[model samples]
Target: MRQALERRRAAKAAQHLPHADLADVLAPSAVPEAPVREKGRRERPEPIPSRRGVAKPFSGRAPRIPNLPAFRSSTGQVQGLYPWLYGKSLPPVGAYMGVDCLTGGAFSCHPVEWLHRGLTSNPNLLITGVPGSGKSATIKGLALRLLTYGVKTFVLGDIKNEYAKVARALGVEPVELGPGLPTRLNPLDSGPLGQHLPTDPIELRDRLAEIHRRRITLLSSLLEVRLDRKLDPTEEAALAYAIKDISGEHDGNSQLVDPTIPDVWAVLRDPHPVMVEELRADSVKELRERIRPAADALGNMVQGSLSGLFDGPTTVRLDFNAPIQTVNLERMKGRGDETVAMTLACASNWGQTAIDDPNGPVRLVIRDELWRAMRIPAMVRKLDADLRLSRSNGTIEVLSTHRLSDFEAVGAAGSEEVAIAKGLISSCDVRICLAQDTAPLAMTRDAIGLTDTECQHIASWTGQHKGRGIWKIGRSSSHVVQMMLTPIEQELTWTNERMSL
Candidate 1:
C-alpha cells in the first residue's frame, strides 16, 4: 500500500513536469528527482485566491433557460417592442419611400416590384386618410420617384387637378376637360386595342367582342349615373339594340369604328323596325318609350350639363409613352356632384382603354377621390372589373379616398353596391392608411383587419406630422413609413399653396 501511494504521488507530480522531467519522474529508480524547470519559464499559477483564504470552485449553473424558436409577427403585433429583430420585410426595390420608423432602415417599395417579388398578391393599392394627411403627397412623390424605373403614371381623373403640376414637372401637359375646353373624349373610342389587332381570325373576333362589351358597359354606366338607378330589362335591351345598330353603321372591315355617344342617342331616338320587333314593341313609339329615360340621359350629355365633351370623337389622344398623364376635372367642381361623378366615370373609362394594353409597360394608374365615382353602382362595378384586370395588365392602380366609410356611402346599407365597393378595398393587397379621426378609424380598422396597435398608430397620427402613415403590405407585414420627398418633389406635391397664401 505504501508503494502504491508513492506511485500515485509520482503520477500527479509528473503532470506538472516538463517534457524531459516527465520521463525522469516516471522512471523506476531508487532515488526520487524533483521536476526540472526550464530557464526563465514561470511556474503555473495557483487557482484564484478567495477572500476567506480558500479557493472556491465555480458552482453556479447557467440558469435552466429553455431554447425558443423564433416567432414571426407583424409590426402591428409587436408595436416594435423588439426592433431590428428581423431583417427588412420588403426588398430594396423600386421607389425609396422613406425611413422605416420601426427598424431605422430605409424603406423602399413599389406595387409592381412587390408583385413581381411575390410579396404581394396584386399590384393595386388603396390609400385612405383625412383630406390633408399627405395622401396626395405620398402618391405624387412615389409617382415621380418611380420615373427612374420606367414606370409611367397616369391620373385617370384628377378631380382637383392635384396631379397637374406633377405632369408639368414631367414635361407633359394634363388634358383639361370641362365647359369651354375644346378637349373631347369619346367613351366608345377604341384605344390601343384597335391600334394593334391580331392577325388570327379567332383572336380578332374575340377582341372585337370584348371591345363591344366594354363599350356597352361604359354606356350603361353613364346612363345609370344620370338616371340614378339600374336600367330595367326592357331599357337595357333597347339600349343594347341602339348600340348594336350604331356599331353596324360605323364598323369598318379590318378596324372597329367606334360610335359616338350622339350616334347611339340618335339610334335610340329613332328605333329601327328590327329593334322594335326584337323588343316585342307594338311600334317604334313603344320602343322609344322603353328607352326614353336612357335616351334623355344621353341627350343631357350632348346638350345639357355634360355637353360637347363626350358627344363626338376624342379630340386629344392619350400619349402612353409620356412619363405622366392627368385628366384635369377642376372645372367640373361647380356642376353638381352627379355631373362630376358621371364625367369622372367617362374619363376613367377613357383613360383605362388607353392603358389596357396587355403588352404595355408597367403603368401606375392613380384614381383620386374615388368615392365620387363610387356613388354610381355601375361605376363601382367598373372599378371592381378594373381590380380584377390589374393582375393581367400588370398595372398598379392606386385608389385614394378620405375614409373607409366612404365606401359605405356608395349605396344604401347592405346594398349590392356597398358590398362591391367594400370588396374593391379587399381586392387591393397593399393599403397605405394615414391618420384619420377616431370615429371613422373604427370602421377603417375593422374593414382593413388592422390590429389594435396599428389602429392606434393611425388614429394618433392625426396630430403628428404629415406623410406619417402605416403601409400594410400583404396580409402580415405592416410598416410605419414616413414618406420623404426631395426639395423638387416638395414643390411639386405642395397642394396648400393657395391656402398658405
Candidate 2:
C-alpha cells in the first residue's frame, strides 16, 4: 500500500511530463466549467478593445452563435429559421459562377417575391437605362431562366443581335419581315405568341389592317406581273379596275378577258392560269366602297393608337435587325415607310386569332429599339398600358432601345435620362449588367442604395465585370440571385451587320 501510494503521488506530480502521467490520465474527475460571458449593461457586442486588451477582449471567447457547432449538435429549428442556403461558400450560385470583374458574386435575394411582381403579376414592364446599360442582356438573361419553365419566346430583333442569340440557342428560326414577305407566326404554331396580338380593339384593327395590306399588295404585285412593268398612277388605277374584273368572275378562278393594264400585262401574256382574275371597272366600283380604303385607313389608325394596344403579350418588332442604317425612313412612302402600321396590324391580328385557343401556348411579342417606331405621335403610351396585362394569359413582349429617352416616348416619363434613373429599376425584376460602366447605368456604388457592406464591395468593382448582372424573380423583389459566372464567350455569335442597333 505504501509503495502504491508513493507511486501514485509521483504520477500526479509528473502528470503533464512526457509518459510520467500516462496512468493517472484515466482517472475520473469533475471538470470545472469554463467562464461564460454574462450580458453586460448593454446587450449589444462591446466595441473592439484597445491594443493591449485585444488578447483578453471582453470575454476570452466568441459569442454563442460562432462557437455553436463546437459546443453542441446543430439545432434544427435554428437551421430551419434561416433561409435556404446551398453550402459553406460565400454564396452557392457564386460557387458555380464567377462574375466578370468583382470578387463579389451573385446575391441571393428573395426569388418568390420578385417572380410574383415581375412575371406572375405585372405584365407590363418598362426597362430603361442609358445606352449599353446592360438592358438587352438583362432581357436575355431573364428569358434564359424563364425558358427553363417551358415558356415560348418570340423576339422582334429590332436593333441589337442579342435576343436572336437566345432564340437561336433555344431553337427558334430567324425571320426577317419585308414588303412582300412578312413572316406570320401563329400562337398555334408556337403556342404562346398567338394570344398576344388580338388582345384589344386597337390590336384587332391592326391585325385586320395587316391582312388587308397583304391582300392588296398581293393583288397589286399580281397586276405588275400581268403587265410586265412598274405601274404608273394611271396604270395602277387601270390595274385596280382589272382586279375588280377578276373578283367578279362567278364560281370561276381569275381568267381576265382584258388584261391590258400595264401591271397585269405579264399575267395577260403568261397567266398562272389559276391566277386570281381581276375585277372589272364596273364591279370594282362597289368593292372599292368596302375593301378600297380598308388597308390604308385601318393601317393609319393602328399607328395613332399604338400604345393603347401593347397591354398584353402583343408585340411590335422594329426594323432594327434589318440593314437599319441603309433604311432611309425619309425615302419610305405609303405603307412601306410606316412601321407603326406594321405594329398595329400585327398585334391586332395575332390577338384576334389566339384569344380563344385554350390549348395555345403563351403569347410573346418582341419590339426592338421601339423608339424609332413610336416617334410618330401617339405610339409611346400605347405600349406601356397595354403590355401590363399581357402576361396573365401567357403573353409577353421584348421591348428594346438604345436611348433611355425612348421610354419617355413610350410614357415612363420623358426623354430625360434621369427619368430612367429615378426608380424604375425596382420594376426591372431580373436585372442584368453586361459589360457597361455602372456609373452611366445608375448602378454605381452610390446609386443602388446599398447598405454599408454592399457599398464597400461596390466601391471596389471594375469593368472586367462585363456580363455581371442582377436577377430578381418575384413580385415584391423577393428572391435576389447572384450569378458568379455566366458563359460569356459561349454567348458570342457572329451577326451584328447592321449599324443602327
Candidate 3:
C-alpha cells in the first residue's frame, strides 16, 4: 500500500510540470548560419546535386548567336515589305458619309474636296452596281450631302426620271424632254459662254471662234451618232463652212442673234458659191452630192423621230444659280437605244455650255446610264474630254452604270472605242463598287483591278443589305462602307414605291 501511494504521488508530480513550446518540441537537428563576407569580397552560390538515376544535358560552351546589323529604309520602301504598316485612317473631311465596315470608322468623300485636299489625283468618280443595290440612293445621298458644302449637282441625263423627285425636293422643276414636250434644247446654243462678249477685238474674235468651233464639233458629233459613221474630210469641211457663214451673218447684225440648226440645214441644203469654191467643187450640184449624207443626218434631227427637240432654239433655260438641275428623259425610255443615244449626245452637248463657263459654280455632273453614251465612240471622246477638263472646270464628274460590261459592250472586243471605254474606267480614281452578280463580277474585278479577297467580299455583299460597297479612294485607301441615311433621305431616295404597289 505504501509503494502504490508513492507511485501515484510521482505521476501527479509529472502531470503538474510546465508544458514545452511548439518550436522546442518540433525542433530538428541544428544547422550552422551562413558566414558574412567582407565588403569587397565575392561569393558564389553552391552547385546543385544530380539525382542518382538522372543523366545531365551536354554542358559544353553555347553555340555563338548571330549578331545581325539593323536595316534602314524609307516609308515608301518599307510599305512594300509591310503593307499593313501604312494602313492609316483617311483624313476627316468633305461629306460625312457613314462608317467604314472594314475598320469600324466613319467615312466621308467628295471628288472635288478630295482633290483640293490632295487626297485624289482627279475629280472624277464612278459608281457601279447591279440594280436594286442602292447605287441610286447612294448617288442621291452624295449629291444631297454635298450641297451643304456649297457644291451643286447637274444631272446631264436622267433617263428614267429617277432624279426628278430629288430635283423637285430642291425646289427646282426638272427639265422634261420628249417628242411632244414643249421643252426644246438647241444643240447650237452657246450656253452662258455667249451671253456677253469681251470688247477687245482679239478677245472677241477668240471667244467667237471658240463658240463657232464648239457648235461645229457638236453638229458633227450629233450627225455621227445618228449616222453611226465618222464624217469624211469633205463632210467636215462643208459643215465648218456652213457654221462660219451663219456665224458671220449673225455677228454683222446690229442685234445679237444666236444661229439655229435650221440655218445650218438650209446652208447644207443649198451650197453657197463661196463654200463650193473653197471645196474646189465642179459646181453647186457636185458640192451638194458630197454633203447629201451629212445633210440627211441633220435632216433627221430636224424631221425624224427627234423632230421638234433640237430643231428650235432652247425653249427652257438652265438655272445656273440653282442647287440642282436635271434633264428628265423618262419619255425616251422605250424609244430604242439609237434615239436615246442621240438625245443624250445632244443633251450632253447642251450641258457643256455650263461646264465651259470659267466663272460658273463648281458642279457635280451626274451621268446616269452612261453606258448609252459609251455605245458611240464619238460620245466616248466627248466624255473623255470632259473628264480631262474636270480639274480646270472645278467640277466633279460622277458616272453611274449597271456593270463594267457596259464599257466592253461599247464596241468589238479590241476596237478603239472599247479601248477608250476602258480608259474612261481607268481615269476614275474613286471607284465605288456595290454588290454584283457573278455574271458581272469577273468584268468588274478586272476593270477595277480588285484583289481576289476583295472580289470575294464584294460577292458576299449581294442580297445582304443595301448601300454597302467597296469605296476605293486614290491608289491605296480602300474601305467597305455602309451608307447610313436619315428618314428624309429614305423617303426621297426610296425607289420601290412601284414595287410596293
Query: Top TM-score: which candidate number?
Result: 1
* lDDT score of residue 26 within candidate 1: 79
Error of 2 at 347 (Å): 5.9
Q: What is candidate 2's lDDT per residue for 393-477, written digit by digit as tens? A: 4455455545343344433345433343333334333333233234444443233333343333333445444334433233322
Say which prediction, candidate 2 or candidate 3, comes out ahead on TM-score. 3
Tens digit per residue, CA lDDT, model 3, 94-164: 89888887677888877776777777899899999999999999999999999998889999889978899
User: Which residue pairs does candidate 1 place in steric collision?
Assistant: none
Q: Which should have the higher TM-score, number 1 or number 3?
A: 1
Stretches of model 3 off by over 4 angstroms after superposition? 1-86, 249-256
Q: Which candidate is the best by lDDT?
A: 1
Off by over 4 Å in 2: 1-126, 129-133, 157-166, 180-358, 361-366, 376-378, 396-398, 410-463, 470-489, 492-501
The window of 10 residues in a row where model 1 has the poorest summed lDDT is: 54-63
- Against the true structure, candidate 3 has what lDDT? 0.83
Q: How far in Å is the alpha carbon of 298 misplaced in model 3? A: 1.4
lDDT of 3 at 33: 78
lDDT of 1 by residue, 369-394 (tens): 98888876888998999898988876
RMSD of each: 13.2, 17.0, 12.9
lDDT of each: 0.84, 0.38, 0.83
List candidate 1 segments past 4 Å from native. 1-87, 249-252, 278-280, 462-464
TM-score of 3: 0.81
